[model samples]
Target: MLKIEELQKRIDELLLKAGLPRHSVNLCTAPVGDGTPYISFENGKYNYIFSERGYEFFRKITESTDELLYWIMSELAYKIAFKYELENRIEGRDGRRIAFPKFIELMTKINPLWKLKAEDEIKKTLSASPYDDSLYL
Candidate 1:
């Protein structure tokens, strides 16, 4: 079984590799009876909510660090892309987004595994939570 402290360290290391600040994303487990995944950002930090299933996914993914890193890149990049899209929608910016693509590119650079896991594959991994739109982006 993986300890939370070690899990936190792997996350922090990944963030630092991506040139992001440690604890910039607060990783948390969902409460009992609340297994649906969720995510939010405020106070300059991302609240990454993980249900029991999500945590298990993390544990399983860790056996292969490349897979773990790739998954993290996908989720974080997608979340950032969603944030930009939401902002653009609110601000009525031009319907052009260069950032999202670059975000994915950076993530891929950090851990190149797009051929192994596409966006569709990511969607297939998570449950049918209403939060999919935000999470899968």
Candidate 2:
């Protein structure tokens, strides 16, 4: 299971280096199929797909996709609590049995500013979310 505390620390460090605040990110999650792994964010609104396979995929991609490191970190952070929930097999007590938005929320807070090479698909993904707007602004 991924440690939220450790991941958060790393995020904080990244934000410090990026010269951004730490309140811009607010992680939030919602139900998607049996499980989902798509990351999304809007103005004060956040949604992402979550699943075990998604986590594994992230781990694999993050390992080799250093260019997408920030996105990978943000994605991993949001999934931390969810990972814990799954690892512990804890039941949903407060409607968050599987929801873990704090991770991405942290990223938004840090206001990560990354330089993503302009590619149709990448631009579409980043622009589609509030991430690029927040980062550039």
Best by the TM-score measure: 1
RMSD of each: 10.1, 15.5
lDDT of 2 by residue, 57-87 (tens): 2322332222333554555454554665566
List the global CA lDDT of all models: 0.51, 0.42
Segments of candidate 2 deviating more than 4 angstroms:
27-69, 72-137
The 10 consecutive residues of candidate 1 with the worst lDDT sum are 53-62
Task: Provide the TM-score for each candidate, comma-separated.
Answer: 0.46, 0.28
The TM-score that candidate 1 achieves is 0.46
lDDT of 1 by residue, 27-62 (tens): 454434355333333443334345563353222223
True-structure Cα RMSD, model 1: 10.1
Q: Model 2 RMSD to the real structure?
A: 15.5
